[model samples]
Target: MIIPEKFNAFRIHQLEDKQIHSGFEQITLDDLTDGEVVIKVAYSDINYKDALAATGKGRILRTFPLVGGIDLSGIVVSSIDGRFKTGDKVLVCGAQLSELYDGGYTEYARVKADSVVPLPKGLSLRDAMALGTAGYTAALAIQRMEDNGQIPERGPILVTGATGGVGSFAINMLSNIGYEVVAFTGKTEQADYLTSLGASKLINRHNIEMGSKPLESMQWGGAIDNLGGETLAWLIRTTSIWGNIASIGLAGGIKFDSTVMPFILRGVSLLGINSVEMPLSVRQQAWKRLATDLKPTKLHFIAPTTITFSELPSAFDAYIDGNVTGRTVVEINENL
Candidate 1:
């Protein structure tokens, strides 16, 4: 494959006024961050972090003038690394793209070979992006929980932020594996959508009274919590003995007051899930499971929207506004 001298990239720059400006620009490979592998990016996806970086709603980029997409799936154009070769299918996620390096929001992405994972069998380039960081994070959380001894027989699992991509995938994957899943969501109106993804019950986060107690009644065997702060504190108190609560996001608030009674008395474990900077073997194992036992059965239902590259600029707002239901994959170069 012959590489283009200049390709389209959605670049983010911090101007002299300290304001963030992002838009499409034609650039050469030399303008990108240093990497051993060059990819003809086939697909990228919208995540809340991607929206924050693009819209300047949050401080996600650690450097100026970087391509803006956290996840990408595509075919390798060339590789100096012995582990990968030209024409190999691969995906990159949770490797600090857009934050510390040029990301996937371009026709071509030059990425560190260490950040790449060979596309697991049973998943296409598009399918990989459909899963993206959201699906990968969900699978990682489940793997950590199960490794800590989480099981269906312990109790039903509660999934907060149940309509979002990670929550939706977690619900579907857990339910498929025999755990009864309960969705805790503010959008109770989307009950049908939640149920379709295999949620056995719904807890309206709006009306529930989370009492101020060191520990509360044990309602859940385990939990996958996306909204942190009070919800996390509540989960910490109410989780049954030996249950693992995987804390993935902090959309609610950062600070939360908690007592150790839940930990000391009940042995409830709170596992922090950080997707970035993971070991290569750990990253590969997660993707392998995402293709097999942990694969989401309702993938299309959870991520049915695929927009062209031209439509990418208009899509981030919905995610920032908390209006997006599931995942949205961006097609950068489908011909690749």
Candidate 2:
């Protein structure tokens, strides 16, 4: 493929032993990695990982002078694969797009043909970006729980980190599907917002005590936990017998000091969820669910405050400070 002469990209360039990413001067398609399809990106969204890349806080960029968004939705401007053609609408997420490859923080992106998913019939490109990686992860978690035999009639389920992107979507999707949802959040101020998202009860994050007890009173029938630390361990110990707990993010920390008594004695299960390496089939199913059963009635309420190309940098900072709520999508290409 002939690389275009000019394109726009948000790039992280090395400067004085540091990396900085923001709106910069025009970049060429020549700067992108080789792929079978070239997309004119319509929308992209900020994730926790995107925040790290924009701020250079983590080693999210495997290479420098890279575009930083991990997810995007767009129209294929050109394609080498017969399965896709020029002008095809599609979306992409969780395929090392930002970390190991040139990504969607640009006006155009060249992506491997197999890594893309066709936009679902009922979903618009803008709505796909609004759901983004967070909503997809939440849907995957819910699917896993159901596949593992979890049912709403068993008991009330718990959602930790309830105000963030994944958590907000999980709460609404679960509750909308007839499950009783108890939401936990550090932000007491967001109680009304969580309630509006269909959370049945709000549990104070501080009140979710993590003590030395190896086990505690049985509580949740199932759980979708985003923060994975002592809180996760506590959730493991307290989940009802034969319940499923899907462990997603690690904003709290990674280490889990847990006991096997919950597994052996209570038959509880801890399912680790990695949205990044999800197989293509599972990814397709998850997004289909997002457009159907797991779709949240109040999805717009969980959007990352929409921003333009120029406002992305500050939005990234707000995400890092934990000040942002739900999903934050960047509108590009005339909001198509």
Candidate 3:
């Protein structure tokens, strides 16, 4: 648990050209914030937000010349609080780690003590990062659905953007709880992969043809929707009476045309899933569930790869290009 004099971090720099790009840089410990806890970070994962922030594809970062990683898991090297101590295994996700603060793409991370979650008993650091924010959001969605009285007996649930990290976790978690999952993705090549992750049925994103009807055939019992536009609108119209739809992303267009017919007639509910500011107690429960009941059986299939710390900059390109099918963790400080 020796703190390094200088650590290597994937630092994003803003140039005079008003463009931002990330690369490895050597920085001293004083350069990082001395929060309640300092962790010798071991694993970090790339998410769509990270890609957008790194590649200037979207407005992900509120500031520049900062380290960028939204999810990280590792061991605590030192703690100023009695709740945590040196040599403790811990993990963190969301909590604005990357957006407004120096983040996980570093040899070490110093974060607020309250933002860290004790790594669940049955989970490894690698597994924790594998789940990361995506899995957390999926769990949050299901918890919201269950609170709305959703159950396996209701009918099949639909997961849009099924090839991405959140969608993959949603399929696995919903199916693990005995709900039949209908996964929708544009990537037809991932048919076998999605099926292996417990998708009972697969639908091509392009094949979903819908009219402007306020109500379509009652289809889904409940749904975990990552895309927002037409797909969400369709789910609202087609979901069975009393069914819930948890909206998680805006990867598709943000707004959609919808009418009151579905809501007035079907009593459908739209739940917005936000993982960043989730209460700490809720995060603990979600992580515990993920380590037990919600643990994805096919995480090996969902997050099938790992990249070294040096490979992180290039990895963002794959995410930006939408070539990433499953989660990939960045291995940091493994050699240390």
C-alpha lDDT score of every prediction, in listed order: 0.95, 0.86, 0.89
Using lDDT, give the best candidate's number: 1
Residue 209 displacement in candidate 1 (angstroms):
0.6
Q: Write the per-residue lDDT of candidate 2 for residues 1-336, one digit (tens) a residue.
A: 234689678877656757564455588877888889899999999998998887877778877777879999999989989989887899999888888888888888999888899999888888898899889989999999999999987789999989888899999999999999999888889988999999889899887566667778888999999989888998988899899999998878999898889999999999989888888999999999888888788877788367887777777777778777778889767756
Candidate 1: lDDT over CA atoms? 0.95
In terms of TM-score, which candidate is strongest?
1
Q: What TM-score fits each model? A: 0.99, 0.96, 0.97
Q: In lDDT terms, how accurate is model 2? A: 0.86
Q: Model 2, residue 201: what's the lDDT? A: 93
Error of 1 at 154 (Å): 0.2
Query: Model 3 over residues 1-336: C-alpha lDDT tens digits?
Result: 788799899877778898886788899777875588999999999999988888888877777777889989999999998989888999999788778878899998999898999999999999999999999999999998998899888799999999999999999999888999999999988899999999988998888786778889998998899999988998998999889999999888899989988788988899998898888999899999999999999887788899999888878888888888899988997943
- Give, for candidate 3, the lowest lDDT window spanning 10 residues: 28-37
Which of candidates 1 and 2 reaches a greater lDDT?
A: 1
Model 1, poorest ten-residue lDDT window?
327-336
Stronger candidate by TM-score (1 vs 3): 1
User: How would you order the candidates by lDDT, starting with the best?
Assistant: 1, 3, 2
Q: Model 3, which residues run further than 4 Å from truth?
A: none
Per-candidate count of clashing residue pairs (backbone under 3 Å): 0, 3, 0
